[model samples]
Structures are given as structure tokens and as C-alpha cells.
Target: MNTTPAQLPHALVMIRPRSFGSNPQTIGSNTYQQTDEGLAEEEMNEQARKEYDDMVAALKKADITVLSFDDRTDPVCPDAIFPNNWFSTHPDGTLALYPMMAKNRRTERRQDIVDYLEAHYELKQVVNFAPFEKGSRFLEGTGSMVFDHTHGIAYACRSPRTQQEVFYKACETLGYKGILFEARDEGGRLIYHTNVMMWIGSNIAALCLEAIPEKQRNEVLTSLEASGREILLLTQKQVNSFAGNMLEVSDPEGSPHVVMSAAAWASLDSKQQELIKSQAHPLPLSLDHIEKYSGGSARCMMAGIHLPLKPGATP
Candidate 1:
């Protein structure tokens, strides 16, 4: 099995936050985000803007094409900065809209972004899963699951935010095999989103396997191993540091670079750092305020634009 054969997205969609903050609706499932009652609205938006700008600048420096869209504040989507939860694009030119658990987050399905992309790229079809939200069954896009595009595998941790029926439906549509498992935090609470616990790259899968149920551990390991992906196990502390939150993308020169947050990079020991470096150049974005408040890190902010480019064009 050939690992690391360019699973990177050609372009990245980052929704620059206008009103980023801790969302109360997500608190039940997302233990990572806490409502900071003392923080004022203006302060939240300002810090988020600074963090968003810095991350965008760093991604551009690495030669990764980044599209920064301003988030809407009128309807008020507090967690709008994490756009990966709302939609995902595919190389087949299919755009899939996910069913968000939060009512306000459901409002995040913005056609304007799609329209903007259509003006630039080639999109074949749109898959709407938003109707599932009507029945209260939700599956937040890339947040609820991580796709190993090359392997035809979708690894997802079971949570209220991710339902099996919805997962299976999506897998059927995307031609992916759904691998379901239960994962918990240190306090025995379910991990809100699979992306926060693990990430599947072209050649490697990084995750805190200990959090997964023991019964399902072998199955998960077997699946990745069968695909010849090098598994990088993370500790609970590292998971909290957002170590699992990473994405691989090619630079302007076509060199693969792995993007992560400063907090996540700091948690790596010497050996782990070298292993990652061997695969791709490390591009760490400073997003402390964004991570602390939004409960999501680098990977969550990046919505992979997998559509085809124009003739003689590059992302």
C-alpha cells in the first residue's frame, strides 16, 4: 500500500470569524469549550480576528492557497470560525452539506460561499444532508468524522453529534466505509468530534487511541495498518493540546506541509516531531485565543477545497 500519495487539499476555505465565542448549544457534547461568562462580546470578536489573520498569513507563507471569507454576525453564529463542521468539498466536484446539531450552526450552511467557489472552481454537484436536521439527527461535516480519501475509509467516534445512520448514509454517498467507535475524554465524557481526537493524512493517522473503547481498538488499528499508514499515537495531554488537529497540504512548490496549531506543536516530543518532519514540513499557526474559546484548532478551521482548478491554474 502506498502511503502519503498527496491526500492534501488543493485549496483551503477559512471563514474569518466575526463573532467567535463558546457556543452554549455545543457545551453538552463539547467538553473542550467552556462558556467564559466574564468575557465580553467585543473582546471575543477582536481576539478571534487577530488569530484568524495570523493563521491565514502563515498558511499563505507555506504556499497553501487560502480563501478567507468573512463570517456573518447578523444571525449570530458564534462558532462560525470552525467552518469545517458545516461542509466538505471533494475532488469528484461534489459539495456535501452536513446536518449540524446546533440550531444556530444549521444557519451556517451558507450558499454564498459555494457561489463564490463556483465562480472560481469547477463543482459538479451538491449533496444536501441538511434535511436530516429536521428529525434532530445530526452529523457535523469533517468535525464528526475524518476521511482517509485514499483508503475509502471514514473513521468516526460515536457521539450525539454523529449518528450512525447519518454516517452510513454519507459513506454510501461518498463511497467510504464507515468505521464507528466510542471515544471518551479523561473525565469519561464522549469526545465531541472525531477530528479533535484523530486526523487521517495521506501517509499517517494521528490519534489518542487510548480514548477509544478497548474492544474497538484492534479494529481501528487494523484498518489503518491494512492501508499501510504509519500510526502516531497521542496521549490524553497531547489530545488536549490539539495534537490530533492537523492537516497536510502541498506548498506552492508542490512540497507537502503539515499545518497545526502552536499549542499542538508544543506538545510533541523530539521523536514525534522528527517523524512528522520526515513526512511533511511543519507549519504551525498561532491560534491560542481561537483554540481556547472556540474549542477547535487548526484542522477545524480548514475546509478542504477539493474541487478541480481551471486549466493551467494552481491553488
Candidate 2:
């Protein structure tokens, strides 16, 4: 398989339901848990499941190739739909498994999923990084690191869920340079995932500039400029709506399409919408319940696999 990043022309996105989980990195995860008089645990899980199914149907209607998984098993994995945090695929057909920070989340990784993909798709190599979990070092795959494949740059924000060592190793192994920085929300709380603040597309990037500290903002700006990507800066409010978490995907005809949540689309200003429309067609799906309950939006649920087209190409 061709290992060159540029060779990847397709992406694999997962539809998430039952996405609500008690993630340690989320700002208000505990609030989602069952309370004495609030919603029952089973009810919340059921609602999340319904929302996930609706979002999946929306994506399918948009012509996005989705890989749907069932969650009918025991010890429900609430965050199973957001697979990007646990695994990533490369153009050379290499699959990299990551170590997650949440104990319940670690169970999201299913060998059966890999086996299924291998049975249908052409897989070249599998690299496991789950050993870091034993050492208490975590790096939640593409959720923690956003890759600019065209320029060989991997952007990451430092957080308890993203370890520097693991981030550096991922960059080195993938032949990319790491641009690391710290980001915080208005409350001065660290952003849980890099996807919440920025998303790198083929020739453009949607970013929440206000979330990045003043000290690191210039560096990020310089890097984006150096990479020759157009910057679509978003506000904190828009980021909360999942605007910055949008993903750029291509159709089977090689037409580029930008995928975002309906909340994200509604949050964009007319000018911002025009700017994005000038580049690619916008595909929005409603994931309101998933975002509110899981604290992750459309982009978090999709894991873009940079796999080569043919089986013999290097990834």
C-alpha cells in the first residue's frame, strides 16, 4: 500500500448513537450521569441512541460513505460512535490504535471492527499503541491531533487527554512535524479535544482563533499561513455549535464536500457560509442531542482513514 498521505482519497466516518459517556476530559460530563430526580440512565442512553440513528441517516442521505456499527451488546459503550479517538488509518493502509484516557472508553476499541474492515477492505499493516494505556499516557488518535496531510503538519493542543510524548511519536512515525500549543475555553478550562477548536481540510482550515491563547495564536497563524491554507476563523459561540469541528470529505466522483452539524451550519454568519460555500458544498446533519450529551459533534464521530486505493500501494 502506498504510505504517502496524498494518496488518500476517501474517508471512513462512523455514525454514533448512545454517545453520552462520562469522559474525564469533558467539562460537565458528571452532569450527564443519572441523578436522584433527573432523567434515568436508561432514558438518557435511549435518547442518545435515537439521535445517533437520525444523524446516521442524515449522513447517508448526503452521499457520505458511512460505516455503521450496532450497540446491542452488554456493558454498553456509550462513546462507540466517536471512533477517531481510539484509532486512525493511514494512506498506506496502516491502522494505528491509540490509548484512550477514559476507562470505559478503552472498551470502545473492538478487534472485531478491525477484522471486519480487513475482511472487506484491503489492509496493509496494523500498528498498536494501546500499550501506552498501561503507562497511563493517553493520545486519543485524531481527536487529539489534527493532521494537515498536504504539508506534513500535525496540530495538537496540550491537555490531560493528549500526552506530549505520544503526540510526538505519532508525528515522527507519520513523517509529520508537530505544532503543539495550549487552548482554553472562555471559562479558562482546557479544551478536551483539538477537533473542538480546529479542523484541517485539504486547502483550508476552520478554526476558533479566540480559544487559542494570545501567546500561541501567532504561531498557529504563522503555521497556517506557511501551510498555504485559507483560514476561516470562528468564534467561541460558533465552536460550541461544532463549526470548527467540521470535516471535508469527497464524494465517489472526487467532489469535495464539507460535513458539519446542523447546529454548526446555523451558527455560521452569512459571510462565513459564503466563504465555505466558495470552496466546497456544505453537508449538514442534525446531531444536537449527541453534541449536548456527548460534548462532541459531527467531526468527532468521523475518523478519516488515509488508505491507498489499491492493495499493493504503500500507505
For candidate 2, lDDT tens digit of each residue in 1-315? 222235223656574455354344443422222222355777777777776777667656766567777754655677777888888876556788999887878888888778766765567888888889899998899889888877778899988888899899888877789999987876777787888889877777878888888888999889988877789898888877778788887655566678888999999999988988888788888776667767777888887766645554322
- The candidate scoring highest on TM-score is 1
Which pairs clash inside model 1? none
Q: Candidate 2, overall lDDT?
A: 0.75
What's model 1's lDDT at 71? 88
In model 1, which range of ten residues has the least summed lDDT?
A: 1-10
Query: How high a TM-score does candidate 2 get?
Result: 0.88
lDDT of each model, Cα atoms only? 0.86, 0.75
lDDT of 2 at 193: 84
- Candidate 2 lDDT score at position 73: 64
lDDT of 1 at 46: 91
